[model samples]
Target: MQGAPGKRIAWLPTLVAKRQDTLRAGHLRFAREAPWSGVLHCFVLDCSGSMLGGQRLALAKGLLIALFDRAGASRAEAALVCFGGAGADLRFGPAVPRWWNERWLRPVGGGGGTPLASGVRQAAQVLELSARRKPAQQRWLWILTDGRSSDQPVRPRHADEVVFVDFERAAIRLGRCRTLADAWGAALFAPDELIA
Candidate 1:
């Protein structure tokens, strides 16, 4: 119980040692890392031409960063997939949200056609790989779009959960987002639900 002048065996509890008026560092020990059982949120953003003028893309990007923060706080993983005229691009990952903020999102621009199917498919591929590695991990696919794509919806294989966040706001709503959600048996949400 005596290594130095003030060193004493206080109490071996809660993995910490408390002396009279100070908490010394010697008794603060660390155990093994805890196992993580969390859902991986794969955000599929529609960076098409329709999302240009209204700042819909900007809103989506901001929401994505918030979601990233939420994922990090929850100790969950996150990914970002952007799709447009050409095809879907995996901007972020099936990786941890290490640098998911405004800085990382600023460079991601919107244009081209809305390849909704492509984005979902690309995110599904990432989910498949993640599934093989962390088989017990749950996967969520979040599609942020205005439902303007003419491409047929194809449900991704590895997504355990799905949500279609409709960004549409027009007189004659095409309701393609509802169609996709129906196809996947997923929940439907508006963009504002994120902030809430």
Candidate 2:
């Protein structure tokens, strides 16, 4: 119906039935009934030295703002985490839909070695704490980084969902990060795809 044969199918009863059952028995109904109270999205940003080049940090900031706007429109909660130099800093909050904004996400001056392990550890801690406070809320962690760090910690055990946005170019060779992401069972995306 939408485009070509690959784009649409006239008879998809099995698939539709499966989707309906999933909606009825899974989190979909719950999410729809109480959207604002049902989910929390955490944006974990890497402010390491590598991000200083190519206006990456600026782009990240803009993306964060856009994410906040989208989350707000959907009545979801959001938080911000910046990691690099020293460690991960919980910059914004476990803030509600209305409170998230650019002011909470100021440009973090960067100039030191990347400490990805510390940042991941801190993000896991924050997520754990948030879970404790709001057990019913579904959690989503979005990690944006160049995947250049060598000292990243063991992947967090408590992440309900995790997405890694790789800022590295296609010409660059894969590093430990690909292994790390695979081990963590997180979805990996390219920065160009996400930001552009």
Top model number, TM-score? 1
lDDT per model vs. reference:
0.77, 0.68
lDDT of 1 by residue, 7-116 (tens): 33222221212322355566543321334755688989999999886788898888888888877766678988999888998988777886667998888888888887
Superposed model 1: Cα runs more than 4 Å off = 1-35
Q: TM-score per candidate, in order?
A: 0.80, 0.76
- Candidate with top lDDT is 1
Candidate 1 — worst ten consecutive residues by lDDT sum? Answer: 10-19
Counting clashing residue pairs in each candidate, in order, gives 1, 1
Regions of model 2 farther than 4 Å from truth: 1-37, 97-99
Instruction: Please provide, for model 2 over 1-196, each residue's C-alpha lDDT reduced to its tens digit, 9 standing for 90 to 100.
Output: 1222232222212222233244332221112233444667788888888877877777777777877787777666788888888778887767665866677667566667788887888788878988898876767788887777877577776667777776765366565556777787766665554443
Candidate 2 lDDT trough over 10 residues, lowest sum: 8-17
